[model samples]
Target: MRFTTIGAAIVDIVVARVRPVLGAKQDVDHIGLYAGGGAVNAALNMAALGGEVSIHACVGRDLEGGLIRDLLQRHHVRADIPDHTLPTGKSVVMVDESGAARAYAQRGASAWVGEQGFQGLDQADVVYVTGLSLKSQAWLEQALSSMETPTFRLVVTPGARQLSHPQALEGLWKRADLLCVNASEAARLCDESVPDADAVSVEAAESLARKLVRRPGQHVLVTLGAAGAVFFDGAQECFHAARPVTAVSTIGAGDAFASTFVHAWALGDSAQNALARATDSAAGIVQVIPANRAGLLRKL
Candidate 1:
């Protein structure tokens, strides 16, 4: 199947195991520059998994933007995104010894991507979009209003930042066939009374899923880091448990899972089977520090 990926591309600077000291320069360890962004990662994952994938990821006309283009080419994912005046988007990710990470995101060129970025996507059987790209009103509107084959699927994986834009959320999510997000993102979309306020339990996560479906029609998939994921098949829900593994880095785990799930599902896998495939793909990447397209597909 042919897949079209639309989203953000970034140069990720990851600093491992360090405490941030606001006022002084500190010793930094395990610093590496990597090509990243929700859409970029997911597109690469799909390409590696043997899907014919093409992407239109927005970036700036700077060194970092070139890096994203080279990275996608290395992974064999096609891209034709144009560069705007802003610098390429980036993230400074700081990981503590315990495998927890905090990221300072700069949505530079990423924000500049509008409806035009997705011009050729309507021809694809599966159009996968990430949380980062949905921030643009034009891009989100384009996806919602585009004319495509009846089977064309709009799979959205929105980040927590999207919650701030309620009008955008209603418009995008209401039309999206699939909604993918982490526990924290789900927590933000739900009401304060939802159980497991921390999104630590299956019941609580399903509570949030139930709410998403009341909007006539939609499917929700909530990924709970170590807890695996919860899949809402319309109103019917199921939780796929995660296997034990020492995570090297949780970054991009959700993107990996979302890509694999869409690829498998488009190929006609059952919902349960698709979730299992996604779980396995994510588990492999999380246990390794850096995952390129080849490494990720080889794991699968």
Candidate 2:
């Protein structure tokens, strides 16, 4: 299965340590930098899992962006990065001892990849659009409309902020083949408050999925953190169990899960198998120190 992921490709400076100070005396124990972002991570995972994947994004003409491009190329992911003058997008991720993270993001050159960047998407079998990339409504709409192939599947993950403007994305959502989101994003789409770590929220998630499935050609998949994931395919409901693992960081787990699931599904795996593989892949990722290792699943 060949896929193209359209979104930001960021240089992530991840600090995986806990310190006492909040503002001034904050001390980090370990700092690791890698090429990362939702789409980048997903595309890398898909490629690592033996799927043909390409990344379509923008990067700055700088050392950091060059390194990121080289890393993606090393993983055999087709890097379709446009040259830009702005610094490459980057994230400062601080993960506490408990694996929770606080991130500060700078969307530099990534935000500049406008409609022209979507010029050659007709060759892809599937296009996964991250919410971060959809921040530019005009560019996203233009890209979606530019698809020349009718068989190209569209998968949309309406990240956190994009859900606030449902009307802006409703048309695209109606055209999407799959819609993936977390419980909070699902709740926001459904105009409900999702409870933290609660079992009852699955119903809310399912409710949101139902509404999304009502849209033509759309299915919904909601990731429920440690509890696992739920999929609504318009006819039935499927739930997958989360793997039990000691997480070092949960930074890119969701992106890994989404890509793995999509990859498995594209390979003709059963829904249960796809979900299981995705959960296992993501669980393995969180336990690893680097958090974005492509071969992390080999350990499982």
The 0-to-1 C-alpha lDDT of every candidate, in the order given, reads 0.75, 0.78
Question: Which is the leading candidate under lDDT?
Answer: 2
Model 2 backbone overlap count: 0
Candidate 1: which stretches are off by over 4 Å? 19-23, 115-117, 133-135, 146-150, 193-199, 214-217, 291-300
Candidate 1 structure quality by residue, lDDT tens digits, 1-300: 999877777777777767756856778667877877877888889988898888876788787788778767888888878878889998888877766677899988876665464566666888787765444755657655765444677787776557666556777777678888767677767745433323468887887787766355678888887878888978699888887778777777778888898899889998899999998998887775554343321111
* Tens digit per residue, CA lDDT, model 2, 1-300: 789888878888887777656586666777777777777888888888887888878889998788888888889999878878899998888888888778899989877655354655777788888855455555867767766555788888875556878777787777789999887777767777766533535666677778767465467889889988888888877888798888888888888899889888777788899999999988988886554784221111
For model 2 the TM-score comes to 0.92
Off by over 4 Å in 2: 133-135, 197-200, 294-300
| lDDT for 136 (candidate 2) | 58
Ten-residue stretch with the least lDDT total in model 2:
291-300
